[model samples]
Target: MSAMQLDAPQVYDVIVVGGGNAALCAALSAHKAGATVVILEAASREERGGNSRFAGTAFRAPHQGLAHVKTVLCEQALEDAERCSMSPYTPEDYRNDLQSTSHGRNDPLMSEIMIQDAWETIEWMKDKGVRWETTLRKYYNIETQKGIIIDLMSGAPVKVVGDGEGLIRDLYNAVENASIPVRYDCPAHELLTSGDTVYGVRTRQTDKYVDFYGQVLLACGGFSANPAMRRQYLGEGWDLVPVRGTRHNTGTMLRRAVEAGARPVGHWGAAHASPQDIDAPLTGDITKTPVIPRYSYTYGISVNVEGKRFFDEGEAEFGLTYAKIGKMIGDQPRAIAYQIFDQKTIYLLQTRYSSGRPIVADTIRELATKLDVNPTVLERTVQEFNAACPGADIGHFDPHHLDGLCTSSSLAIPKSNWALRLERGPFVAYGVTCGITFTYGGIASDDKARVLNNEGKAMPGLYCAGEIAGGVFYHNYAGGAGLTKGAVFGRIAGREAALRAKGAGGEAARFRPCKMEAAISSRRTA
Candidate 1:
């Protein structure tokens, strides 16, 4: 799949850097808009798709209940359609969630574009052969005639059929079907620019430098995997945290974009970090399997190394507070924390924790000793927490919504919701730490997905999408928004760049063999 092996073109209309979802979407869209496109992926073919491959397969979108959701669903999902029920996620609901999570710090224009285009983009991807399914059936109450009624707080109801890997596979198939060539292991190192306009990219191919001339789209992702950048941008001890995504997203292209005069935007100190297994590897599975995240902390109490409850584990739903909790744990001693659960709330844990190795004990003291924390402090902490709980009754404990079952207000850090007394025997504990998914800081871009200079003007011939285009998120994030944001902006960048390249037609445009019409006219290789 190397570009050098093929009869390479002298130049293309669009050259997309990165092989993730955004880059694939851009390439597919640009090819549809009648442009010759090529993709430059930093990873080899086997390890391609960047962080998007490791991402959870869900997407948060504005839908008019299950009727609208069925429009983008696969045939398999449609079979069980009658058993599902979802309240309509209106445009206002989407807007408010974004604002509330980012604390109103998200770029208004970018947020607006995402909200407006989210559903349409999902439909577009579905038309391009992507299949979707509603996940987390347990979050819905399945006893009623309506079958499973979704929880409003669980914003992301739909996920791609095969998760992240399935998403990238479908998109890559679309790209190949459209005759767009993707060159793996060809990492773009420098932007080939003419003054303020980017014209191409210089990539490192094997042992030599190869230049691919075209309208450039940068979607190479954030620098969470880079230790120097993490420590420098995210502050102390960040470099030691586990990476939840690809190790190839080292910010080479992001730094290059900034060096080429693109303005940096968003919260540099914040990121999409979240809690995962303490034993999880730094770069996920060797086969690039998605890491099993432990987001069931909302049903339990999390304690620091000192055996004291540090923060409210149920301050909000897991979607809104997981990133904040991850950062909080990362700031704790040794960047470690343990989530304690009892028999009462153990069944409420999500299936994502099925692979976790929880330390089990019949008593609080035994559990503390197994966790390596001071038994006296841990026992006291559990006792104090138990005294604060309302009662041991599990009837009022609803896992779907914020049932106001909270700990006593007099406690130093009161549990806001789902507070159950940990008095049951056979207690369980799962050790956790921060897993950095992606950074929130990168080169700036406009609503149209055009790269912006320091003066806020759109730079000609340059565009960005995916995690590389920041400002949509800040301190917190809603689950599934990343995939939507990428698709919406990737399509936008692809179309805008293609139009510009078509309008700026020169000798490259006259070279018709690489064009869409020529590929269709000849024996198609895709």
Candidate 2:
């Protein structure tokens, strides 16, 4: 094997695969720990960050107070950061939330690791030149009372700086500062192993196989873009769903790992899906990683192919329960659903609505016809919905909170909260279909980030993190949790891999309690 200095390892201590956030964290952490590491990124330099690039808006990490937050943020943002809530989140709080969200099906140990280490790992990344901010940013909307609401979740609410792209760039810069080598367009084709004891990665460069031997850490993503894998694992119509993020996450490493005896866990065909804009492509664009999804569906109503409602639009908060509705829409007649809104609450929308033109008509019948649904069914459905609503007007609606306004008990599916009738003229509807994000199921890894074999024993010299290493999320995920988990476990995996490679540490390196230092760093990168 001709060594690709970042291309092929001549005598490296660690080989990190998939150069997204998780892989970057692993590479940087291993490098910091004195492991001569090389990163193998699938995409070329231009199309670098994987799913990690899609996130940056928010993450639920532990913080002591505004002071703790101001430490990583720029001095300019400190004033505004003090205004927002920077309350502490204990390990128990995070663990409980994880358990409740996954319905107790999440791996207990892995969840614990994610919760405990998230804060520390985030601080570590900051120490390595990554900047984080808590500055309240916003843009005014026509419908809001104040005209401008804080851009919390939509922008960088309380996560790393510059969102996902910013976070990745900083890490990449840190790698450069450390003089770490990264080989772009060189994906791992196979894991070189002897009797299940993995040793290195095999890749093809210029039509020839080259082996890079080292302790392998697979932070590569899951199979959101691979249709065959999606169909085989997730189910039928899953193949048609749009990829919400990167097209490069085709589950190649996952398949190779599974073939190499790694056990697959989580819901095979299950994924975190969304009712994406109809104009959105099957593979998302690199320039526009959506800042806002079509979450305003709850303010109006979602109708199915037969021109009727299937589930309650107001069952829960739109921001909280996207997975449930996405699944419902995915299970619908063509895996399609139209979010019907009227002129009354149209101004309440942001990026998702304003991004494209909507199907508009002066009447419900015309709008239904435009949406290709039975006009009579649509009219009748609206009439019934309006009749069921006690107070159906702009005056009674409240978008900021779940107002008690609702549809009457007579309707099949009641608009339980924020219920307003679509009675006004020029009704607008945006056709949407399910967009699959990432597969929840993956190779089982232990608390220390070691990929477990079929019998549940740790696969020596092998570690996994990010979306590829499943067990943390089962069906649904909190908005920023995936990013946090990737960083937390990625740090742990890299630390352990480096220690094991040098034979310098034992279990202490693999599974030690989180030690968060308040030693703040002053690095500004927006």
Best by lDDT: 1
Give each model a TM-score. 0.92, 0.86
Who wins the TM-score comparison? 1
Global lDDT of each candidate? 0.83, 0.75
TM-score of candidate 1 to 2 decimals: 0.92
Weakest 10 consecutive residues of candidate 1 by summed lDDT: 1-10
Span of 10 residues, lowest total lDDT, candidate 2 = 515-524
- Local accuracy of candidate 1 as per-residue lDDT tens digits, 371-444: 88999999899889989989878788877678889999769999999998988879999999889999999889
**Candidate 2 lDDT over residue span 275-294, tens digit each:** 77766677867555464367
User: Model 2: how far is 50 from its true place, Å?
Assistant: 1.3
